[model samples]
Target: MLRMLKKMDGVILFVLLLLMVMSVFTVYSAIQSDPKLGNHHIKTLQFYGIGFVALIGIGLVNYKLYIQYAFYIYGFGIVLLILVNFIGGTINNANGWIKINDYLSFQPAELFKMILILFLAHVLVKRKNSTLHFWKDIVPIGLWTFVPFALVMIQNDLGNALGYIVILVAVLWIGNIKLSHALIALAIVGVTFFGFVKAYTSYHDEIFTFLEKANREHWAERIDPWLVPDKATSKASWHTKNAGLAIGSGGITGKGYMQGTSVQSGRVPYTYSDSIFVVIAEEFGFVGGSVLLLMYFILIHRMVLIALQCRDRAGPVVIVGIIGMLLYQVFENIGAFLGLMPLTGITLPFISYGGTSLLINMACIGLVMSIKLYGQEDEDELLMGEQRPTLLERLWSMVKKEKTTA
Candidate 1:
């Protein structure tokens, strides 16, 4: 065990520790600012403890074991998502959480993200040599991706649904699909997105009327705040407005710990979860926030390095999916805080105070560590020319060959 520990990636481990320390401090400040939150930092500490255990436990296991049972794990995730729809408690109008008790809830979507990565890595690596055709290859991959995506969408969880989309794109890109096929797919997506935006902007009333008639008023309610903020008085828009205020107020050095007016006044909703970035920025200022972002950059860089050193296709594919997941969440959450993107209620991976998200993220790091520890040397090492003979040995071999020829 100590030997394995010694072999683990130190840079990734250091980044994880740095992020955890920051999370503890930031979560404590966030809870302290609001009297109603009631010492949530204690719970956050417990989660970190649990998450660290999971990280170490999974890191010690062979990552290829996950690849072998990838389908089974994915199936289990699907079942959980389906079950959550029927028995889950609603939070913020999304029925995506399974209540465990009065103070605990489990989000299947969080676990599903990891499972999707595993399954896709397994399937894509298995089909590495298969010819790429839309109907034959791409369609099956799309269907596999869309199943969990549609299930999450049904729960009105657009954030996680979008996360699934990112994972799919990452896996497909790394899976070595034909270049021409990938270009065509990208073109179709681009055209579709452009068409939707044009139609929404040019025919707002007609489109809204259609949405109302089709019983998609919820979608309208969520989108309207972003598209027409001047007239939006909804709670979602209110949250975004305050989030922006909190971020903008924090200039360079921040207002000091637990001293944010917006946070203390309880104006920013979801301070410890979705709006945690706002809390960090408001209290720690631009420097602190930049430090956090630097940690994330280092974490992602280390993961990419591990992926590159992997001996097999599965290791790199799995890491790429993880990279996609983290990148999207970070981009979406921070973008929403700055009002550059619509609020998507996605947690900021390690720093956010969510048990399920933190645990799953730690598990992902463990997987990467496993690849680094167990996977063989780079294929380039094997591809290098056979060991060269010493100068004397080479000369002796040449003399022997000449004698034979004579």
Candidate 2:
């Protein structure tokens, strides 16, 4: 069993372990004095153990098998998202979690990321000529991607829905789609966005009309706080204000773990989850922040290296999808903490205390290991729709072309 785990990418596994350790520390700090948090800590650890086992087990298998079930898994993921919208528990204005019981809950949006990767890999792996065009190549994939995004949006979970768009763009770029098609699509999106802005500026009535059609005042409220920040003195600015104070209080070296005044005093809202990075910054200061950032750089670098070595398109596409997920989460979380963006309820990837997110991320690493295990040799070229070519066959083709030219 140990050897099996070792067979996967060792760097990824090590990084994962480090992240898990960090999360436990954060969780412990969050609820060190409270019974509820202490109990949650135990439950979270147990789930993490199970997730680790699953990750290793998944790595031992061939990744191609995942491709076979991609569609079904993707379908199931969308269904779960839909279910969460109607019946899921609401926390932080986003109905993205499915209550499993009183003690545990699962976030379908997290699972949806993995499922999207599998599905995209299946479609793009066998694609001939990496030139993906919009109407011809991307539209079909967009249909599947958009449905889940729309459903998540309806649930008022803009953060996760935005994450889906990130994955789609990353995969499409990796697949080497036609550049002209991308420009055209961008133009269309730009035009629509401009129109909406103009309408909002010109008519107050249009804003109400749009809000009524969406059936959610949350969008307007979310922006109102940002636009007229002076009036929005509630939790709208809670994470931003507290996180800044935490960073300022730390100075250069840090206040030491559990010594963070803001975090320990519960002044930093969502410190255990969305604003966890702020806690790290406050306790460990710039030293810890730099180390965490460096770790992420190394992790992303390894993932890219794996993508480059993959002989099959599916493996590369999957890695690309994973990259997208990580990138969005990092930027969103950090940006929110720094007040660079609105306080979007996004987690800090492996560092955030979410069982579902952590498990799915480790599972993705397992899949990457499978790709490496079964990956073709570096020199072998994967033709779009053909078998390996013999040396003689290649020479004969070259000779025939020369003769015809003569």
Candidate 3:
């Protein structure tokens, strides 16, 4: 097992560990000022430890078993998403979570993202070269992606829905999709988005009128605050404003742990959870933020390297999909906090305090490790050779041969 892990991607594991540690420190700072939530920090650390164990355990299991169960897992995941729409608890305005009594809750969508990756890997591995012509061969792939997207959207969890789509695009691109197909898909998305904007403009009066009728003042206020921040003073904009202030106050080196006024004063909403990164930025400063960003870059970079080293297409697809999910969520969470993007309640992967997300993220790492443990290296090198050219390739092949044999 040690030999196998060594053969796998060490850089990714190192980066993940660094980020996990960072999360504990940051989460501690975020909650330390509040006596009501003082003990929450300790509880979060325990969850992280448990998640680490699960990640290692999963890594030890054969990745092939996951492939075998891809369809069933995907089916179950979709069903969970569907169930959550009716039975799920509301967080903010989005109804996307399921409460498991007082201490634990689960997001079916989080579980679904992992399953979708597995299913995509299974489909792509079987479809093989057929994926060359994107649309011609990738409609089935789109179906696999969209079913979850539609379900999550119905749950009104746009952030997670978008996360799912982003993962699909990343896996599809890495799976050897045609460049033209990618462009065409992008074109379609642009056009659809444009149409949505136009429709919103034309129906603006009607929507505003309906907002009054429904008395959804909280939900209705988002558009105005987002559109014109200075003019919007409602609760909808308060989270965004306070988050920005916390990040801005951090300056260069930060104010020191537990020294942030807004964080300590509890000015920033969701500081210990969805917007935890802001607290880290405030107290630790830009230096700390840069370190956190570096950790993410390393984790992503290592995951990509692992995918490239995968014995088969499935491993690469799985790894890339997970990479996409993390990248999207990180960008959404941090971007919104820093006022770079819209407020989209997406958790900051392992850093955010959520049991379901932490478990799923660790489970994702486990699968990547599993691929490393049981995966064949020779097959990937051969595939890599096929993508290149020449008789020196034979010489190059002999070198790889020696390396594998050695």
Local distance difference test, per candidate? 0.84, 0.77, 0.79
Candidate 2 regions off by >4 Å? 1-4, 32-35, 186-221, 224-228, 377-406
Q: In candidate 2, how many Å is residue 104 off?
A: 1.1
Q: Choose the strongest candidate by lDDT.
A: 1
TM-score each candidate. 0.88, 0.85, 0.86
Candidate 3 displacement at residue 9 in angstroms: 4.0
Q: Which regions of candidate 3 deviate over 4 angstroms?
A: 1-8, 132-136, 194-205, 210-224, 230-233, 377-406
11, model 1: CA deviation in Å?
1.3
Q: Backbone clashes in each candidate structure, one number apiece?
A: 0, 0, 0
Q: List candidate 1 stretches off by more than 4 Å.
A: 129-131, 205-218, 234-236, 377-406
lDDT of 1: 0.84
lDDT of 1 at 307: 87
Query: Model 3 over residues 1-406: C-alpha lDDT tens digits?
Result: 6775576567767777787777777888888667777766677788888988888888988776687668898888988988888889998777888999987788898888888888887777766555465455578778878889999887767788988889888888888887888798889999998786576556766766786786554544655455546545567688888888888989999999889999888888778789898888988899988988888887777777677766676788888889889889988888887666767778888888778888899899899888777666444323332333456988999999999999
Error of 2 at 67 (Å): 1.0
